[model samples]
Structures are given as structure tokens and as C-alpha cells.
Target: MSLVEAEIKPRKSLFVLKTAKTLFGELDALVADQPANSTAARAIVLAHMRETLVAARADAEAELLATSKGIRCAQNLCNAEDEIISAIHLFATKRVYPVDNPSEAETLAVSAVGGYGRGTLAPGSDIDLLFILPYKQTPWGEQVTEYILYMLWDLGQKVGHAVRSVDECLRMARSDMTVRTATLEARFLTGDKTLFDQMVMRFETEIMAKTGPEFIAAKMAERDERHKMMGNTRYVVEPNIKDGKGGLRDLNTLYWIGKYFYQLKTSQQLVGKGVLSAREYRQFQRAEEFLWAVRCNLHFLTGRAEEKLTFDLQPEMAERLGYAKRVGMLGVERFMKRYFLVAKDVGDLTRIFCTSLEFNHAKDMDLVGRVFAPFRRGKVKIKGDADFVIDSGRLNIAKPDVFTKNPVNLIKMFLVAGREELLFHPDAIKQITRSLRLIDSKLRNDPKANNYFLSILTAPQSVERMLRQMNESGVLGKFVPEFGKIVALMQFNMYHHYTVDEHLIRAVGVMAEIANGGLRKELPLTHELLPQAQ
Candidate 1:
């Protein structure tokens, strides 16, 4: 009973149906006298299909211009792609299989998997497809799949496809996590629904049930590795919005985790269970919608599926997104800033979602959980009359107004974390985050709090790590308001290798290394002058 239950199927869409029918009638009239399976007949059908696809794309773009809702436009594009693929499947099946009556209960299943399967087609993105057989792959299935792929290629679509039996699919899903993840979002486009259903049933009952934790671990590791690969930072001059640390993939990861863990149909279901509040869900929707709009505009601008928001396109995209130059900032700067803000929202949502999963599903420390525990838990110590107590390496904040009551405690908690080389538990982090605003002008200039912050920053152990944790927890920005402006701030020139915030953090890390004599060989001059520098 979720709001989003079905794929954005073009066959079910009246606009697509009307468009396809009109084009098909023209194709039929042109090939009326030719043999059904003749080369000329096939060419006619292909041409008509291509023409219909082009027209549909134009309509979708027009819709985007009219409404500015990229989701709707993406769905429209998916629907058009579906209609084209479905038509091709039917056309080729008759020639190859020669069934007088084609019933979905009897043969192969043509499914759209991955991004395509999710029914959000970015312009010029690859059409990932699957041809599912009830049993083993046969000659007929092979021929049909080949014909469809070739025709799609002829129409200039970049296609990635696989032909697999139900058994092969299950085996692949079990063996390869990427394959499994892609298969999880597979949607039926044209062919045997029964076959697709059988695959879905077996995947859910047999594959998905036992593999949730394993899959989660693998996916989290994969995300960590990806973040490392993508500079281990969310802010970049030119970021890949689809795969960067806090990009669309992060958002998609949360949804995937929810779907696997809860067997939920739609993300809307997560709201009902308090996994995300109504406000958070609205933020989620806005971030997704904005990212999609930017992505769609990028595709249209570059005439391909261009995900990276390069410097050159920033101004154009900003203007297109209705942003104009302000007094000091250019249109492009404002646009990039907005993009980073969306990415930050994505980061916030990711933290909220992963925290929910940790409390709800992580009953015991699995291997992957242990690997990522640093991102969630902290050192255990119960001392003083603190409102919160640490039990079993987890910080439990017993009082909600702990920080509000004593603002200096903000720097104290981070000091304790830094001195002990412990991470801030999510609960502790959450409390601190909620009370960040309390560190106002007076508190920032507070002698005691400032001394505590400086001591933590200069701490011998894990100084850089603590600083980053402080920044991520929003403490650094609150303490030094000017620092907030440079966060995720990209320098347009090539001389600066990292974003402003990243460069600053790296500077601190390098200083920490030099202070500890860890960079003696790299900086002998600094090492010799270490005492004077100190």
C-alpha cells in the first residue's frame, strides 16, 4: 500500500501509448506489402521506433522546461524507452519464436535492471537490460535478445545487457554483490511476468532474507572504498554527482539498505516507521529532485550522460537553475554552493539513516560492523557527574539538555574524545549537533572553550582525526563562523588541488605530522627548525 508501488511503465502511460500507436500505424502503412520478417520490414519498424523515441525525448524535454520537476521528466523518458524496448521485443519475438498468441505466462522475460530498471533514465545513459528465461537459455531466447539489442544499438542507445536463466541469476546474485544489488531493483518491461515473478520470489525468499547483513557489510565497505577513491571528501571542484561520497549514490545506498533490511516497497514507508521524519523526508525529496534536475540539465547540455559538474558548465547550469550573480559571488559560485549544500543534505540524511540502521539492525558486531564501528561508537568511560554514561564502548547521553546547561562542555566532550583517541558515538554526536547553535559569539570567544579547542587540536594523538571529527560534527564551523563559508568551496583555478576546507584540514594534518617528526625526511628544514616552530 505504499505510494510508489509500480515502475514508471510507458506501456501503462497514455501519452506513450498514443505516440507509439501513431508511429506504428505509419510503419505498418509503409511496410504493408512487405513480408512480415523481411529486412525491409524490420528496417521500417526500426526507423519508426527511432523516430518515435526522438519525438518522445523532445516531449520530455519540453515537459522539463514547463514543469521543472526532473523526476517527472525522467519518468517520461523511462516510459518512452520502455515503449520502444517493449515494441522491439514483441516485434522480434514473433519473427524468432513464431507464437500465434504471445502470453507472458509462457516464455522469456525482458527486464530493465539497475538505473534503467529503477525507471529513471538520464539522457544518453546506458540501458541496462536482462533477458530472463524460466529454465536454461535457448536458441530462441538468444536470438530474441540479440535482435532487440541490435535494434536498440541501431537507434543509438548505449545498451548493456545479459541473458541468464533463473538459476544463473540466483547464482550470480549470491556470488557477486554488484549483480545482486542491480538485480534487486530489476523491473519487468516486456515478456513473461511469471518468469520475472519467479525470479523475484526466489530472490526474496531465498537470496535476500539471509544476505541482508552480508550485503550491508559489503555495500558499506564498497562505499568506504569509493569515498577513498573519490578523494575521501565530499567537497571537490568537479564532483561526480552520481558516485561521489555524498552524491546520488549515497542517497541510493540509504534506499537500498532500507529496501533490503525492511523489505519495504517505497521510501515513503520509511517515514511511517520514523526512520525519517516528515521534514527529513521532504528534505530528501528536495535534494533528490534538485540533483536530478541538475543531472538532466547536464545531460541535455553535454548531449550525453555527463554527471560531473565541471567548472565550465557551472555558470550555464546556474543560470538555467535560475540563479543570478549576487554582489560578491558570481552565478557559478552561487550554483556550486547550492550544489554543495544539496550534497551536505545528502550527507546529513546518510548519517541519520545509517544511525537508524545501526540501532535497529546491528544487534551484534559483525566483521563489517567492527570495521565501521569507529564511525559509530566511542571509548567507554564513566566518570564525574556527567549526565551520560559510557557502557560497553558506547556513549549514552542520559540528559538532552547537557550542552545547553553548560556550553563549555561542548569543547570538553571533544577534548575527552581527542585525548582518548576515541570517536564520538552517534548519540553523543547527535546531542552535540543539536546544541551546536548554543556555541554563539560569546562562547566562541570564551577563553576556556577556546583553550580546550586549541589543546585538542594540538593533542599528540590523532590530532588530525579529532579535528576532522570536530569539523564533520559541525563544531569547527560553529566555533569559527568564517570557516563555514569556505567549506565545500571550490577554487575555479587548477593551482588549488583540493577544496578550501580540504586544503585547510590537510594543512593541519601535515602540521601534526611535522610536529611529531613523522615528516622529517620530507621536510628536513622544518624538522631542524621544529623547536623554533613550536
Candidate 2:
């Protein structure tokens, strides 16, 4: 079994349905005298099931609050949901609409999709389900599916459901990326095992076969769109934990790409697949755990699926997560600071993962080069320097120890990328991150190194982008210690939309945009002044 399946597989010891048999027996007795199709009888049965399951969910949630175990809480919630859904399926087929000697067309395979399919559920999260029919739907199949959905709706459970045949699923997935992504995480819950197995076999062989590169490109485009929608930065004060840039969705995108290419069972397997190093995997795990904890708490606190970490709830969330006041910082401020740092780590992991894909030839380097072609005027000729090389239109260190030999190379690399209008190779960024300790006060104050840093800051092409790369790789902060202090600093004011360092970078980006005529219509005065000042 996959790690996710195992994590959410209801433990017999802590099973939510410990008293399910007795409850079902009582339900059977209650409906014994009434007709199976009787509306009054069905109401009673549904009510009984709803009451019982609601209490079980409450108990599970209370345990979660007491233990403060976020991942386990999600698992147990999913397990509880599974028990409820499975019980409803049985009840619907046997009692509500019994079919004698059902035909092949009547076979239905139920599966969980989306985040629910990953075997994690926060309080009030929608339970996304997919019902797979053998071929065309039969009367009995439709009746069973509707009955199950109605029962869940009556229980106040939000459900996102779809009924499709194997062929229909494949067709829709082929035409729709959202559908394809949803089906990628589908896990069979209950129903016709043979039918489910057949669907999985065909999906892997037909739909997913040789489509890894396309899927990766599509996901990257989707991610870029999402980031743009969410302020195009990870330092938003009231961040959306699920959909914001560097949020849970970003992490899931990494997992999805890895899984699509390698059929990874767990995210840990990404390390083995060379998609992530061991240390980076740990960073991934930590960020995931912290984000999940925050999301779960958000839901519990709001009594709904609230995702944004708004100011009103920040203090309480911080307190609940054990964040305490420090001498100069409030607990909420500290909590938010940690959250932004984790988001930054996620951004790092994304770069590392993409680089791995390029290095492994899983991603098309030519496509990547084309994506960044708009920023290039023409590649500037490189002076005599063996320390750097251009690979697939990105700047890369020629040797692993280039930075160790001269810490000043850290500053020079970004300067070169800016002048040439290129981004850093993932390996180059990794090397810079590892070699941060070598950047000391002497190097920071060196004439050549300072000159390189200034050149990067004032570069006519992609100045903002280069500075962000440097900032993300730890080079900007190391070379300027004052900037390091504000890397993740929260302003704790309603007016400030981003962290201190992010605000500074964004201000620079705005100036660059004005200078380049990108924002001339909106800021003509700034555009006029930018060239003059330079």
C-alpha cells in the first residue's frame, strides 16, 4: 500500500465505527416494518446515520485538539469520512434500492479524489468522490449513487462528486487538465474491485503513458498563473495557506509532477528518485507538516474551511500552535514570520525540483529557454572567466568549488546573470546556498564584490528578477547583513501587505518596471524620474 493509504487506513483500535454494527442493527430494526422505498422510513434511517457519524466526527476532532497532532488528525478525519461513506454505500445498495443479481453494467467503483484522495481532511473540507461505472450507467447504479449522495448531504457534509465510466473519465481527463489532475490522485474507496483495477490499468497504460513532459509543462503554467493571482509573492500578510504562492498547492504540485513522472507512492520516494535530496526532503516534510497544522487549525477555529490566515485569528492561532511572545516580537508576529520562512523554503524546493527535472532530462530545456526568451535582447558576450558557463540559456557555475575558491563569485554570478539576462541553473543556486558560510565581512566589503552587487542592482534587464534570485539563494542577505535581518520580518500593520524584505524588493521591481516602460501608463512620473535618477 502507498504511504498515504496506510496513513489513512482506519486503525481497528481507534476505528470511528467501533459501534457501527450495533447502530446498523438498530437501524435495520427501525426500518423493518416500513417499505424499503418509504420516505418516512428512509428519513429515520438517514437521520440515525447522520447523528451517529456527526458524533464520531466530533469525537475525532476533540482528540485532535487535545493531542495537537495535525497530520494524524487529518488522517483520522479521512478515516472517519471513509467509514461513513462505505456504510452509506452498503445501506444504499442493500436496503434503499436492492437489485437482485445485478448485471455487469450495474457495477460501480467508488474512489476518493483531490485532497481527500490523498487521505487527508481538515474540518469542513469537501469530500471529493468519483464513482466509476463499468460501462453506461444502469438504473440500479444511478439509484445507489444518488441515495449515497443524498444521505451525505443530509448529514451536513459537503461533497464534490462525479459519476463517470472508465472511457468517459479518460476522455474528460485528456481534454481537461483539472480533470486529469483530479484523477491523478484518485484512490479506490469501495465497490467493484475488478472494475477499479481495470480503470487503473488502462489509465496508466493509455492516459498517463508518455505524457509526463506535457503534464509538467501544464502544471508549471498553472502554478505561474496561481502565483500571479495570489500577488506573485509568498510574503502576503494574510496569506492563503492552500492556494497562495508557496502554499500547500505549490507543495502538492511538486508531488504531482514527481508522481506523474516516477509513479512515486509517497513524497519521501522523491528523494530516492533524485527529484529531491535528503536534506531538501526534510525541508519539504517540515514545511508540509507546519502548513497542514496551520490549515487544520484554521478550519477548526472558524468552524468552516477558512484558508486565509487573517489578522483577527492570527493571535489565537499562534497561541494554539505554542508560539510565545519574545522580548521584541509578539507571538502572532513570530508565527507569521515562521510561516513566511516556510513559504520561502517551499519556493527553494520548487527551484531545486525543477532543476532536477531539467538535469534528468525529464523537462524540456528548449521549452524552458523559449519561456524566458522575451527578457533577452541578445546574450551579452562573456569576458574571459572560466568560473561561469551558460547552460540552456541559464547561468551555471563551471565547477562546484568555484565559490569556495572565491566567495566574491557569489556576487559576481548574479551580476553575470543580470548582464546576460539569464536565470541561475538549479545546481548553481544549490552551490550558492551551500557556500553561504564562506561569504564574510571582508568579501562583502571587497571593492570588486560590491561593484558586482551594484551592477546587478542597476542592470537594465531583469534587475528585479536577478535580485530576487540572489535573495532566494541567500547571497543577497549574506553579502548585506542588514538585509538579512529583515528577510522574513513582518510589519504587523494593516497597511503593509508584504514582509519587509519583500516590500523592498517589490519597490525596486516597480521602479524597474517604470524604467522599462512596462508600467508607464500607471506611473508616468516614476517612469520619468527613474531614468533621470539612474
Candidate 3:
């Protein structure tokens, strides 16, 4: 058995196991007879490896058809690939540079990084890896890394790989946020566990120490940029499920932050620490599972790593996942609706979780919180019961009933927050979620609450930020029942850049900018004609 098969649990199905055993036996025999330095032998090994991989994928797909669970199917696919990679590694190691000590092969540890490292890989996703050398690249380490890459290329696997020594990893991680995040999620696949252990220890101490604030800031910035690129909405009609604003990337970002700051091994740990409510954790799991299923279906259908829920692919995917046409909607629309809902949930969970981090790690979060320092120093306060406190300009509502006791406080919070250009500390947001039931029809129709919400929409500054927070916290939906219908409403076109809610919020933000004369520089014609037009 291969190292991956032996070390990893939940073995492949009997069919797959037998197939792998036979194919691996053949490959092993081939590797044994071929001349170690012969290029011809390398070609033979590559051919056999490719055959084995194709067979493995076929077996996995058959298993998927039987199980019908995306998570299990994906994990099984990864396992099959792991064993295949191991076989190739063993063959490549023997051919490129025969190990004299045998045990000395432990000097080079091969690990999966990024999505592959996460162990829920989408079919045909790039296999990201790290070749961790005990020291700077020696001849043996160089040959081994080169051989692995060459063979993967020959087999036509899209690969992102890095060759680094332990010290080099630390230096790069300390300097680059992207590298740091990837390194933090690295998983040992084969070879030196001892070396992998040392690298992980140094990673925690040398890379993770004193870097929480900077890392969080960088991730947030990256997320904002990504949202901007994806039309700044979770409800894009043809959303990129993996990288879109409120997609799987957002979920992963939450996990990455939790892992980094709290040393969490899994998302469940967040619930245990009270950072995430049990209900919120379920939301996270459902979103993740749904996205994973959609992604896997997309990959299997297209025979590549395709994540975008494009027009043509929608109907088939919907039908595959058991959606059927209804009275007013097509199966495709229903499916897309559910997908957008998942994205929205991911957004909500992210807001709730990050807010917890900000509140709990205030001292460690100063680097990002500095932007709100001036507001914190001011006396701007909103009406709340004894449950409220201002921490670094963010309103923290400690009482669970703060919102229920006065449901208008939900709309009022946004109104006050936008007017003052402040934020709700994460705890307050969590409280708002618990109080969502209080925002029933009576509260929604209260003229005073309605006016307060409008006032928030027209706030001179921070209108967009506050409105987004309201949407994320479920306040907007509960306050305006109509708005709830369009939370993740898809337009099914390219012209509409955002979902209905996002578009509405963005328009309000633009109106606010115009009201403040902030857009005068860009809208010369509007500025010139405003007085006469009015």
C-alpha cells in the first residue's frame, strides 16, 4: 500500500482499492526493471501514472453516483489522487536519485497546501504542494522536487508548487501575507513527518507570533478587492462559487482567521469557544456543504475546475441536485436562488464571527481598529439599555434582550451608526440576530422605525457600510419583508452588476455621495446642472 493509503483512514471502496492495487503493482514492477537514469524509463512511468489517475477518477465518480454526498465523494477523490501521487513520488524518487540510506528520504517532506491541503478538494482543482527541505536545496532535494513537477506536468495536472527550506518558509511567511496563510494550512502528505513537524512548530512561533493584526487586515483588504471585482455582491447571477464575494472563499477566510488567532483546528472549535453560536455553526456547515456540492458538480460536468454558475450549466446542475420546475420558477432559477442564499448565510456568519474576533481581540486588533480611533474619542452615543458600551467606536450590546425590549433599536442602530460613521461591535450584531423575531409586522410598519431606516439610507456618510451591516445582520430583511425576497435575488444577466439588495444599497450610497457634493468632481455635468434641474 502507498504511504497516503496507509496513513490516511476511510480507505477507498473495494473496487477502487483493488484497481489501485493491481495498477500500483504493475507500476512498481515497471519501476523495478527500468534503468534508474534512463529517460525512456521516465516516459514509461509517466504513461502508467496517467493511466492509474484516470482509472482512479473513474472509480471515484462511480462511487459518487452511489453515495450522492459531495463531501464524501470529494474526500474519496482526494484520497485516490493522494495514493496516485504517492506512487509517482516513490517511482520518481527511485529513478532521479536512489536513496543510499533509505531513511534519509525523510529529509524532504512533501505536503499539500491551500485548497488541496484543506482536504475538500474540488475535482480538477490545482494540486498545490510544498517541497519542504530540511535545509537549503541540496542536490538530492533539487532532483526530487524537479522530478515530481516534471511528472505532474507530463500527466497534465494543473499544479502550484513551492520548494522551500524551513528557514526560507519562515522568512517568506513573515514577509508575505498570502504565503503566510498558505503555509499555515499546509498538510503533510508523504516523506518526512519529523521535518514537517519542525516546520509547523517554527510556522507557529516564527510566522504566527505577533502577526494577527496585520494578517487580518490584509485578508479583509483582499476580500474587499475580490468583492469589488465580482461586482461587490453575493447575489451575482453567474457567481463564481469559489472566489465570489460571499462564496466559499468567504467561508475559508473565516476559518483561516479562526485558526490563526485562536489556534483552532476546525470550524467546530469556534462554537465551543462561544465565538459562533450553535445555529450559526450549522449555517456555516450548510453553506460549505452546498458550495462544495455545486463545485463538485460543476467540475464533474465540465471535466475541469469550473466554478462559475453560468447560464447553460445551471439547468443540468439543478436537475442533478434534484431541483424541479415549479409554478413561477424554473429549476435553474430555484437552484441559483438556493446558491445565493447559501452565499448570504456565509456573509452573515462571516460578519458575526469577525465581529466576535474584533470584540474579543481588541488589543490585538488595534492595527485595523485605528481607522475608527477618532470616533472612539468622540462622545457620539446611541440610546440603548444598560447592555450597551462603546469600545473603540463600535457599539457593543451586552444584553440579549436589548433589541427585543425595543425592537426599533434595530433600525435605530443603523440610523445612529450611519450618522456617526461608527460600527456595531460584533457582540452587538450577535445580539441583533437573537432579536430578529422581535422585528415582526408591527415593528416593520411603525412609522417612526420606517423613518429611522430611511434616515439611515440618506445618511451623509457611511451609508453603504451601515446598510451592508444591516443586510448582513438580517435587520434589513426583517424590517422590510419585501427586501427579504430579494436578499439573494439573481438577475440572470451581465448588465445588473449586483443582486437586488446590493444594487439598492449601492444606489443609496451613491445618492448620499451626491447629496454631500462628494461626487461633484467626477460628475461634472451633474454638478453643473443640479441647481437648474432641481
Candidate 4:
């Protein structure tokens, strides 16, 4: 079974519902003795539930620390919160504001949205809820929502909520991409199932139908803007596990796309839909599990919803995750290396997913191609190579065995891409990755292969992008074994902001920018002497 499919044996200590029920029963007895609706009675209930929440969270954290099962901990915590909210809903309706015969407008359906709707809760993560009503707001509906919100707030939960009728939800989702995305993940938690089901039907027929392209474009743009804001790289020493490139947000983006376009309920469904192979799905699961584990550790260590893997928390996070000191690497260093490698895997999976979207015509080809397209100065002649073909202005292998037939094609592929100013088709990249074992010592030492590598490195056109692609695709590392060792190596120090391989690649990119006059104004001296050295 895949990691995601493995059942998590529930730990009784982490189950908050049992503890919550006992406390609620005690609070009910106390409230019965007090005057109805008295401030003192309300205080008694709030205090008891507050204590329940605190103890439940503490117990869950303790269990997580002991078992190191972060994914299960997240699910358990979410389940606990579900029980608490359900209990609140019952108390508000049955005890506080009893309605013998309710009108349709009085009905309310509570649904979890966003990350909460996805059935995971990191420590300190926001609890997002959507309250759906059958029609315009009734006094009872308002009262119920206000009561639930205030109760959750009093218990020290960070709750984000919206109360909307079904029509309002459809209208708002039509105008707002964020609302639409959240609604896509909406999972009914408690309340009128009929109302929630109606909203889902309308959302599918009225909003989601024939709008896959628009939603995909907006999401891709949003992701690009976020990546630009988050330093535009996944290799930063201190990375944001939630929003950084190749972080949880990237994984979430893939899931969002799959869900929006294909109506996939879970990422595993993507495999059955042929968007991802079984192996790729395994990669997805492993990366998701590791990233969540790290994010959970960060939240526990800081006692808040901390997302960044900062240096100060690195040691404790390493120790908590069971990383140990090795011959030359600290536990923290080892931990970070694993983090970067996982991040890279995320990037690869993203490329594969996006390419699948492109093939399905769900994603814009121009936008995807522009990401890896180098600056085009002038038209260049195309070299005749039967094994290669240009498709949609991107380089692609003519056959699957192009690389296996001749391992040197791995190095030559980059050369052709650099020379032609084209991006490798995602399938070609996938093929190259699968054929890395073909890059033996003989192929590495071959003069023709070395010459192709040298040509790519010294090319007058920007070599930075091609070299980076080679590194990411595993060609540079396998062909040049020295670079392989440092692929994700982290230097334990404050001065370095990136892993050794990333830092070196960035340095080369900077020099290329200076040589190409892209940064001449910023570094005139270096630009002036760049040619003199040549």
C-alpha cells in the first residue's frame, strides 16, 4: 500500500472526542443547576470547553512527539475539532435556541473549506468554515452562526468563517477565484445535508462546468505570483514549507488543478485518470508526507503555526524528526539535505503534472513554454537529428528510447536546447530521468560527450538556464560525478543562503547575466573585466 493508503492506527490518547464528551457532560450538569441563559452559566460552559480544547491539543502533541506520525496527528486533530463543533451545533440548537418546527430558511449547513476541508490540521492553522443557509438569513440562522463562532473564539481557536445562502455562494464564487477554489474543496462537516448537496449541484452545473480552462489559468497565475514573492527558488536555506517553491503550496496547486479540471477527489485519483503514473503518485505521497511532518514539527516547536524552516529551529526539528549526526554532517545538515531533495522532487512532479495538463489542453502552452525559453536573439538553423523533433517550439525526443539508444544524447539534448533556444518537452525530460543509469564512466569520459558538456557550459547564449535544467533533470550530476555528490549538499553556516549546488548554479547565472549585459549597471567593474579575462 502507498504511504497515503496505509491505515493510521488511532491512538486513544489523541482522540479528543472522548475527552470532550466527558467534559461537556460535566458542563451540562453545571448549566442545569444555574438559571437559564445566565452569564455565570455561559461562563461555566465556556471554561469547561476551553479546558477540554487545551488538554486535547496537549495530548495530541504529546502523541505526535512520541510516534512521529505527523500526518495521523493532523487528521486526529481535525477529527477532534469536528466533534467539538458538532457538539456546539447540537447545544446551540437543541438547548439554547429550541425550534420545534423550523422553516426552510432556518436550516443551516456547516461545511469545512480550504485546508480544513482537506481533512488535515497543523498546529495553529486556521479553521475555515462555511455556513450554508437555504435562503436569506433568518434570525435563527444568524444566532446559530454567531454562537458557534463566539464559542470557538472563546476556546482560543483561529477560525475563519462565512455565512452564505446557496445563491450567494454561487454568485460570489462566480466573481472570486479564491472563493471558487475553496468551495471546490468544501467538505460537509455538520448540518442539513440537503442544503449542502443542492449547493454542490448548482456549483457544478452553473459554475464549474466548461470553466476548467479559466480556473486553471487563474490558478497558474496565482501560483506564479506566489513563487515570485517567495524568493522564486526552493533551495533557500530557510524555506517556507507552506508557500515556498516546491513546498506544500505547490503540491496543493497540483491537487487543486486535478480537482478542478478532472473532478478528482484525491491526488491518488490522478493515477487512475492517467494524469500521473503509479510511480509518480508514490513520489507525490512521499513528498507530501515528509513536508507535512516537517511543517508539523515546526508548528510544535514554536507553539504556533510557524511555516518557515529557519536556522534557529533547525536543530530541534532535526532531532524531533530523528535525524542523527553522521561522520561529517550534523543532524541539522542531514535534515536540510533531505528537505531540499524532497523539494526538488516536488518540482519534478509539478513539471510532469503541468505537462499532462498541457496535453489535455487544460493549460496554456505558451505560458508553460515561456518558463524555460531562453532569450531569443535571432533565428538559428535547426540541426538534422532523427532522434529529436520540435513540437510546439519545445524540444522533444522523437522516440522513448532516444536516450537509451545512445546515452550521450542526454548531454547532447541540453546542447540542442541551448542552441535552439527551446525548452525540453516534459516527456523528454521524464525519459532522460529514467535513463540516467545509462550514463556510465565510459559515457562520461567519452570525448564527444565531454565536448557537448563543454559547449553547453561555454555557450555565448545564456548557459545558466540550460545548466540549471541539466542539474534538475539529473544529467549534469550523473555525467559529472563531482557535481552529483553536492546535488543537495548543505553547508552548515550562516553565510550561505542556498545549498552548495544551488549556490554554485546561481553564481554561474549571475556571471552570465553580467556578461550578457543584463546586470552591467549593477556591477560595472565585473562586466568590464569579464571580457578582459576571456
Best by lDDT: 4
Q: List the candidate 3 regions with Cα displacement exceeding 4 Å.
A: 1-23, 30-41, 62-68, 94-97, 100-106, 136-138, 367-391, 445-447, 451-468, 493-495, 507-534
Q: Residue by residue across 27-67, what tens digits does model 3's lDDT show?
A: 76786866856877777778888877788677766765554
Clashing pairs in 2: none
- Tens-digit per-residue lDDT, 1-534, candidate 4: 112543467646644455435545676787886763567877877887777677767877877887777777787777778878877777677667778998887899999999988888888899999999877657999888988899999888999999899999999999999999889888898879999999999998898876777787788889999999999999999999999999998988888888878887667899999878888888888888888789887887899999998888999999999999999999999999999999999999999888767755523434444432333322233568777887655688887888878888889989988987777676787788889899999998899999998898887475888888998988888888899999888887899999999999888888767766787678888877878898
- Give per-residue CA lDDT, model 2, range 284-375, as digits (tens): 87787788778888898888999999989999999888889999999999999999999999999998888777666623534545322322
Better candidate number, 3 or 4, judged by lDDT: 4
Candidate 1, residues 1-534, lDDT tens digits: the string is 111332333433323444444544566677788885788888888888887888888887766665566777677788888878877776676543567764443478999988888778888689999889756444666777778888999999999888888999999999999899889889998788888999999999998888777787787888888888888777787888889977888878887877887798888888987788777788888888878778887888889888888877877887777778788878777788778778888887888777667765556325355524743344344566365556335555657777888888887777776665555555676678778889898998899899988898778567788777777777888888899878767666767666777789889889888777787778888888879865
Quote the lDDT for 210 in model 2: 61
Q: Report the CA-based lDDT of candidate 3 relative to the real structure.
A: 0.75
Candidate 3 clashes between residue pairs 3 or more apart in a chain or in different chains: none
Model 4 — TM-score against the truth?
A: 0.93
Prediction 4 global C-alpha lDDT: 0.82
User: Could you list the CA RMSD of all candidates, in the order they appear?
Assistant: 3.8, 3.8, 4.6, 3.4
Clashes of each: 0, 0, 0, 0
| Clash pairs (backbone) in predicted model 1 | none
User: What is the alpha-carbon RMSD of candidate 4 to the true structure?
Assistant: 3.4
lDDT of each: 0.76, 0.80, 0.75, 0.82
